[model samples]
Target: MVSLRAIVEDETTLLNALSLTIPEREELASITHPAQRIEWLACRLAVRRLVEAQGVPYAGLQKDEFGKPHLIDSPWHISLSHTTGWAAAVLHRSRPVGIDIEPIRDQFRRVVPRVLSDKEITHAASDLNRLAVYWCAKEALYKLYGKRQLTFRDHLHIEPFADHEDQLVGHVRLPDHEEQLMIRCFRTGPGLLAVAY
Candidate 1:
């Protein structure tokens, strides 16, 4: 099970109202881009919101060797993604998960050959926003897959589907393990948000 939380503030707003722990503040301080810092701030705030709402006291967070974030004192799994105007986080107490948010853009067209398989291209419905949604799905799946060596074109694939649903399925084909993933994307004001688990 995956639980999602999102906030619609831009990075500047989050920085102005920053409420992060010392370590999280240090992490934000290390980010060079103002916008990137904002994304990081938004994600941490969203996670705190989720944790507080769940009746758990927000604790510190830690990173695994891969730099994936997790609670320092809890068993819940976490994944986060942030874009220009939004930040999102996913929590699953029992399993790994991933989440991403991206604006609908024609940019996916330039990377179609690199990110989508032939089947996925056909599945993308020839629309830029649809393509972005599919692209975000593959990305969420990749984060859930957790290894950095993945090539979206060859290793990640989404089954063909109508573009009208809030949910879709993706496949990860590694040399040793092939699995189906459940993914969902939603319109977030000006962007698309996707989650996989």
Candidate 2:
């Protein structure tokens, strides 16, 4: 089973509603920036909700050297993503998962070279939102890969698809591994949400 949740951040209620245990509080205490603090809390809360729904007590989360988050002493896989005012989490009983939340921006074009191949750019064509879809789909796939080393332009590939489609498949190729990821996209207010597994 896979559980997903996304919520717009409310700074006022975030702290009041979140009753983080001492360890979880310590994990985020170093974050001085308000935005970062909010995102961190929102993600933990989302994950907390998922685990609670599944009748599992919430454990603290930790990260590996690659910064992929894992629930302490739990076998379930988790992925998190957030922007300034939104956060999302995905929990999977067995399969690995990835989720990303991104705000569409005109500046995304400037970073196209770093994130997309020539063919991908051609596939996105002149439209900007389609570019957002490609960028977001790739971001989700990158998170799905979990490791920190892969390059979006080199290791990730997004097959062409309509911007209106509910889902898309992403490809990953490495010297030692290959995977086909199923990614789903949705309109999240002003930004985009992509989840993969």
Candidate 3:
């Protein structure tokens, strides 16, 4: 099973509404910017709500050497992403998961050479929405892989899919390992959310 949630809230409101553990508060202290602090806290609150909804107590989170977030004492795997005003998270019962949320922007066109392959660029066809999907899909895949030194244009690949298609297939091609994963994408308000597992 997979559970996902996204929320938009200002820093002051998030600070007032959510309670934090001592460790969580200590972690928050290291983030000096108000915007980043809000994103951090909001993602945690969203994850806590989703876990508690499943009758599991929220035990906070820990990160691995690769910086992948894990439920401290639970069986679920989690991934988090935030952009501007939005924060998003995903929890999976038996497998590693990745989630990313991004707003569509014109910048997607400029990064085509760096972020997409020939076929992916052709599939996008200079369309901002399609480029956004490719970007988010690759980002989700990168987070799922949870390692370093992989490039979107080289290591991660997304199979062609229409703008209206909600599902996608992604490939991770490393010298030592290869993987195929399922990805799902959907519009969320002014942005798109992608989840890979």
TM-score of 1: 0.87
lDDT (CA) per prediction: 0.79, 0.82, 0.86
Clashing pairs in 2: none
How high is each candidate's TM-score?
0.87, 0.89, 0.91
> Candidate 2 or 3, higher TM-score?
3
Q: Against the true structure, candidate 2 has what lDDT? A: 0.82
Candidate 2 residue 175 C-alpha distance from true site, Å: 1.7
- State the RMSD for candidate 1: 2.6
Q: Which structure is stronger by lDDT: 2 or 3?
A: 3
lDDT of 1 by residue, 87-157 (tens): 77888878878888888888999899899998888767578977988889998998888877689999998
TM-score of 2: 0.89
Which candidate tops lDDT?
3
Output the better candidate (1/2) by TM-score: 2
